[model samples]
Target: MKSSIKRYLIGRPLKSNELGEQKLNKTKALAILSSDALSSVAYGPEQILLVLVTIGAAAFWYSIPIAVGVLVLLLALILSYRQIIYAYPQGGGAYVVSKENLGVNYGLVAGGSLLVDYILTVAVSVSAGTDAITSAFPSLHSHNILIAVLFVLFITTLNLRGVTESASILAYPVYLFVIALFIMIGAGMYKIFTGQVTEALHSPIGTPVAGISLFLLLRAFASGSSALTGVEAISNAIPNFKDPAPKNAAKTLAAMGTLLAILFSGIVLLAYYYGISPNEQETVVSQIAESVFGRNAVYYFIQFTTALILVLAANTGYSAFPLLAVNLAKDKFIPRMFTIRGDRLGYSNGIITLGFASILLIIMFKGHTESLIPLYAVGVFIPFTLSQTGMILKWLREKPAGWRVKLAINATGAAISFIVSLMFFLTKFTQVWPVLVFLPLTILLFHRIKRHYEAVGDQLRIASCEAATPIEGNVMIVPVAGITHVVENSINYAKSLNADQIIAVYVAFDREEEKKFAEKWAKWQPDVRLVTLHSQYRSIIQPLTKFVDIVEHKSKEMNYRVTVVIPQFIPKEGWHNILHNQSSFLIRAFLLYRRDVIVTTVPYHLKK
Candidate 1:
């Protein structure tokens, strides 16, 4: 029963042909791929300021340089991954890339990293969205965790329903948010350039603080680099795209990159221009909205957009987690259950598991985007580094007839990404070391599962030692608590057993009731003999044990076998157990202690 439950939770195993039914068109597919990248704008700026806070308000200006650097990194990474999509467009993602070029351990590391990042993406986005809403309505601030958990539950249920359903629901809000953000940024930029900017409602400048260090700048870079988290989603989801997978995926990647760059730059620059302080502020989006649209409009707009983006960002994981699981299952890294398709042809078990994990994170972090930000970027960067490195290795091994310049570009891209990843890890480990823990744990889990499968195969390969033979006799035992359906079934089973002697013993705590029952049974069945046993404490086990001993003694004297019959009822009915007694198990156990006596159960099915 326990094994059955585990199998149900893990889902059934499936094959490649089963996945053909899940094919998605380019537009819907692009939405799934771009969700994480596009949603980063929701919290990316806030993360930048969170790091800069230590350096005081003046450090806010550093956001511009960091944003610019992120833009450059984003373009480089996107172009590199575009090559990835073209080369292996079947959605092998970092796992496939690293395995093909960098070896299996590297592939496992990359896969684990991406899996962790996908979970964090959902957690952080949902938490950030909840925080934004609670910020708008401070009354809900204290209950943010509960609210976030509820939101996670809702999103999880939606995703479990199917990927296409989730994608369709998410598309409108995400697109609306993108359009709104662009309009706001464009308007704010116009206001800044035209010298029409009003002073930020709450200027982050003029705040005094201590000295700044290179470490502070590096930390800021690490935080700002979070903007690059979702770029790999495109590569992971390439297989879900319409025909011409590589071209569509590349177009989606490029589109996502350009929009993210423009949005991140605009929000950061506008915040700086309006003198919005990053150190003592809400999200950069909030500050920009407040600066451009005044307190009333921007406050609510930021709230709404943040909520929209966070919810939509979860769509990335909704699509990616199952696909990754399918890949892992195919490679035998994970259990075959992960490879299964659901009724909707989606990786239902994987989606549900990812959703549940994300919800736990949201609950633990209380939907605070700031709290989740540290753990967010590290896993993403690990995969980014490995993936780019894989691309370089692929380029070296395949030596495809790509232009020499392109090969050099891929190598340079890989080198730079690797350096950035190392830097980010060093700077952010204090904050993200938890995710580092997850990486090794996941790898260990994979290997352990692999070993388990191999062990099972080994066990099943062992040959049977003995041949089968027919039994000479079969003895059945039935225990009855009262003269009801239970006893009736027991009598039927005893007759069916065809044993040498069938003993029907009534364990009587009350002498008067025992006498009445014996008289009644004698009148009903003259052939069946009733043995009445006395119990001072109304205990079933002691009386049944004594009765079984008597039967064994008689069997030895008469040279005949003893069979005890126990009547069992279906446990599914609610009141069956309450109305009936559990004498069957006790009687069975008592009879087992005796060498010659055998016990059997007679089942009585009750309507639920």
Candidate 2:
């Protein structure tokens, strides 16, 4: 029944041979891998305005400069990650680069920071998308959290269907969003050219909270840095591309970067020329669409696609987080389960884990995009700095052709990204302190997990090398509830072991039940010896395990190997099995952990 539900939700299980067939082409790869970066234009410019607007209309002009700075940073990242895609086509992103070049600890830090950013991508993107929705309707504003959570779950399910399948489904919406924005930008530009809208729609009309200064500009820059959050995803997922993965991925990255630059600059330009101010209720893009095509289908189209692409932006995280988790798992820094692929060949464990974590963040922040923006960029730029730094070291160490130019480019990126990261930390310290605290703690946890895995490996290796302990004979103890077929089956299986001694034991709460059981056993006249144990506390497993312990103590000097055979009744229907006492499960659970004891279950299937 569970399998049926899973099949219906995520489609039928995909075979391993079908994996390569799932690699995405350039267009689909752009939609799947670049959606986050593309979709950031919806909120990235807005985040910049959100900071600049604090100083009122006087500072609104700074949005363009801040955006240009962000664009410059974007170009740096694109160039750096292009190199990354080609240099390390295997695609662990920052984790692989930093770990290989810098060391394991730096790699883990990069990995952890990237993980946190991926989670924030989902939260912030969905929340920003929800803000877009609320802007359009206004009535649904109160339920934004619920709306955002539903969208997160929707995207999660979509991703669980497998990467290529998700790309096919998501491709149209992303393209539609791009088309809608371009049309809106062109239409807005035509309006300005034709002089249909000569003046700014709404002039800034408030006292400046603080005068424009270097600190304010840095804050605005840091806020706008959210635009660059998903830039690394293309590098991280090069293997998800088609034949000639690296070249295809690099082309897609360039294409995505180009689109992002055009859309982001256009939006910020329109917002400034139209004199649009950041609204708590409606977004700046929504206002721009209204200014260009007021309250019409085009306007709603912009809003709808903006909401859609933002929600799908979470797809970047969904796509990258699982792959990153797989890398960490392979290194023994996380549980090995993350390394296992699901029936659909995607990393289901990592996908589902990212889903739940993002949902939690949405709830905690109450789907407020502004509240989440402060915490978003630090995670992104930390890895950005580390990855670029790693690449610099790579170029120097490997000295590939044109290594000097490569080193200079990476050095520029590393310096710029490091400055941006520091600015984000200094400007948003109050809100971002938790993330700063999270980085060290998460890295420490990774080290501890690695240590645990190493310790386990050492113990396993030692055990394999040591001599086996000598055994005198086998003693089989079968716990019986009554002289039923299940118990009879268990005893027969125990006798088949050809042990030195076999004991059928019963634990009874009262003398009456014990007498009845004894009479039944006596009439059967089983070959094995029968022992009865009395439980004053009405506990069955305790008395049975106690007897096994006593037998083990008695045979300790001789080293007799004790085996507990548990007889479990198997109901034809799975749900019916829950109605039974489950004593056999308890006995096995208790004895299976013992060093000297062997536990096994013999099942008797019932027809009805």
Candidate 3:
């Protein structure tokens, strides 16, 4: 039943020739890779504050330090991953790097981590976008889950059409968000500098609590690290870039890095300057919009634009998940389903699977952006650690001319990323570990799947025991049912076997019908004789088994081996099996118990 449903959802397995229909270009690839990175500006600041607020109002200032740290980490990661893209242009990304440098276990860890991160990217981006929309329309506040699910469905449909299409559609909205954010930041800065600043607009109504602790700082850092989530996508997607893949990928990485740092830093600064509370209660972007543009046309317009960009940002997952699955498929870590392209030439199955998982997450968390935050940094940090580790290994192996400099850079990057990853894990374990539990389980599942495929491959290998060879004095028995295509095909198959003697057997369930069939057969081919076996119980298997036993006994006496050619009808529909029952299967099963008998099926394709 599940197999039937899968067939209905994805259709039959496709041949290799069908894969070429969908191909992605550099611009589209860049758009996809950069969307999630750029879109973080809308919520990364908010997430930081959401965490810091737990430590009291003064902890809100920690956003500045955390943002700076995140910026440094982001730049370091970008530089390190640039080396990765140059070294490996394949689409394996972190998994490929870790597998090559670290080990298979490390690679599995990286792959599993990246898989979870990509899933969270979709969920967080959509939920954040939903929050933006709900802020615009308070009525939607309670129905965020429904909105998120519908948005996931909508994104899934667009992705099903193909990556190039979804990327192209998303490019404009993401670019618009970038432009709008820059304008808002510029205007806010102007207001601050001109001494024309109005009362701190959108300021929290009550005085915020004031205190700080090491745990709060760690939480804030983890929250800020959300901006770093999509940075590795460019490295993983080097192959999707245009010709001169390495250079194009490097440039895309640089652009993503610069854009994310500027946008995220700008939002954090503006929010801080305006006395916007890093309280979990308010989104930084919402406060900024209300402050800068007032609760009027411009404020609402910015809200609408931000919401659109945030939602469209999920296009990153729509693009990355399919490509990641394809890489896994190539490595045999995932089923061949991931390698298949849909009618539109996209990885439709992968995209739909990603969408479903995202929707489930959004629903499970009730589209609450804050609750999903704990699970957010864990997955991203895993890939960051491994990717940086991969770079360090690459530097070690190649030992470039500036060996000392490159090694130092890679070593430092790896150490920092590793530390931050550990911090994120420790800080988020209580709130995030539940979602992260899927990581190791996924790795084990992939390993098992790989083992299963290997076992099947071993079974399919040709064995010397079954090698085709000439049979000595082979006797053939053809199961006949009157003068029909089934009988004709079975006889032809027996002749092809090069048997010493061929006997046609007709089983008599109804004596009169059997007699009529024998008479007709005799009239058509007088040279060939018909042997009839009577079944008083009207059971085909019992009569066939008795007849085959007699034939084998006779063949043994003649010093020959017997082969049976059974004529079988191909069922046009699944229901056709119920109409005809399992007579052929029973006969084949019975014949298999005999040592010297070889049972072969001669299929007769029946017209619908």
Candidate 4:
């Protein structure tokens, strides 16, 4: 049954040696790891435009300068994370760097922040993708959340199948989205050169507000910083790359950063000149494409690829979140279940948790991409700031060959990231407040989990146990249903435990039944003492509990460990299980909960 499920869920199980074969190359790695950043160009320009459009048309010009600023911030973070890739090639970039340089508490903060961000990335990206579809066909609007959830489930399934395969599957759409964006940019540039975009720009322009405050522009920059959210993911998952992992990862980072910058800047230019504004009906990218292509097939192509890439952007979280969770699990910050790989050697537990969380967010927000966007960028920036600061501290203390130069770069990166984080916090305070609650709570959870693992380790310390001496005595008790072959088999298995004393217990609700059992037992001559349990309440478990308590107390004085061997009924067919009382399960529940008692169930297969 288990093997059937494994094959069905993840195909064949991969051998440990196949680990290297699954490592992703530069192009595929770029597609899988950078999907989040690359896909963000779809709505990132619009996010900035959202704030600008709110204060009216004159405030709209702030987008180009904010785009420039966002590009600069993106460069800083990219360069910062490249340092992270080389300095900590084993991947655990944020948590490891912070713990190594800053402190454990700081690392916990970064870890918690990154965990939240990865979850939010899945939620926001999937929600935005669904929004793209509903925009295309308004009749599908009611099904957006359902579609978003299904998308997450599909992505989770792909990731569980394997990292390389997920990347290979998603690479085409990512590249197509990139190509479509460039085509739109090219078309926009042609219109710009011909001075023909003036009319397009005028249509979507709103009434100018009285003034554009500096605070508003800074807020625009903060909104635009959403594009930089996934930049650090490569550093956190560098080990998943092929040989010369660091070099390949660093090159992928460089390529992703350059492409993101160009796309972001070009989309901002197109948004401004084409006069696209935030609307409930369509995205700014859709507006830009329509302006550039005039409802042509190319326009639909761009929109289709845009929607696909947005949905698939959750691939980044799939690639990085499980790796992050595994790092945390290794350090005893989360449950060990997160450390167990699926048949494809992926962190299956983490992937499932991420998918569930993303779906919850989608349902909670009702698939409104606008509702999720503000909360999305805040979680991402916290880790970005923490990781960059951690790197600066690393350079300052290490003083490597190019320590001074690296220190200055990381310092600038850290400063910019910290400022952006502050802006996000102050600007998106209401929408992002849940993370304020979630981050501290998550840190508390990490510490609590660590303490729990520590306590378990201490209790199970084999070094502290006395060895060389065999267990001196064993008291085996068999709870019997009646005079049956199954009871005889239970006694035989108990004899194998080499018990110094074996007692067969029978619970009887009637005196006549007890006498008949004793007569049958005497004739059978079972090689064990028989104890009859009288139950006034006519309950099997009640009489069994009393007998167990008395035996457990007596054995304590004799220095004998108790082993309760019960005859467990095994139904031959699935439907046959419903016909059984399942009393052995009831007894196992009572016995295994005690500290010093051991319960073993010997399965008695039934012919029926």
Which candidate should be chosen as best, given lDDT against the real structure? 2
How well is each residue in 1-608 modelled by candidate 2, as lDDT tens digits?
98898889999999999999889999999998889999988888888888887777767877877888888888888998999998899899999999999999899889999998899999999998998998999999999999999999999998999999999999999999999999999998898889887664544433254678898888888888788889999888887888899999999999999999999999998998798888787889998999888899989988999999998999999999998998899999999999899988999999999999999999998888887877887888888999999999998888989999888888988988998888877888888888868888999999999999998887778466666778989899888877688888888888787999998898989989888888889779557788988899999878888899998888776888888888988899999976877777878888988778889889899998
Clash count in backbone of candidate 4: 0
Query: Residue 436 in model 3: shift from native, Å?
Result: 5.8
lDDT of each: 0.74, 0.89, 0.77, 0.85
* TM-scores of the models, in the order given: 0.78, 0.95, 0.76, 0.94
For 1-608, candidate 3 gives per-residue lDDT tens digits of 76676555444555557544344565566667788888878877877877766665555566777888888777788878877787788767888888888988788888887787788888988998898888778876888888988888888877776555677777777777778888888888898788656544433433354566677776677777777778888877665566777888888788778888888998988877786774444467888978887888777777877888777778877777788888888888999999887766777788889998998889888888777755776677777788677777777787878767766666767776777677767776677766457777888899999999988877677863455434458878877656887778788777776678888888888889888888888887676667888889887777777888888888777667888888888877777888886767778888888987989888888889
Best by TM-score: 2
- Tell me the tens digit of each residue's lDDT in model 4 across 1-608: 86687688667889988999889999999999999999998888888988888777666767877888888888788888888999999998788888888898888888888887888899889888988887777899988878999999899888889998888899999999999999989889898989886754543344445767778788888888888878889988987999999999999999999999999999988888777778889888888888788778998899899999999999899899989998899999999999898878888899999989888878888888877777778877777777878888777777889888788788888887788778877888888888879888988999999999998897678885645334458888899878778888898888876789988888999999998998888778566888888889888887787778888778777777788898986878877878877788888998888656778889879887
Candidate 2 lDDT (Cα, 0 to 1): 0.89
Model 1 RMSD in angstroms: 6.7
The per-prediction CA RMSD against the true structure, in angstroms, equals 6.7, 2.3, 6.3, 2.6
lDDT sort, best first: 2, 4, 3, 1
- How much is the lDDT of residue 168 in candidate 2? 96
Worst 10 residues of 3 by lDDT: 199-208
Winner by TM-score between candidate 3 and candidate 1: 1
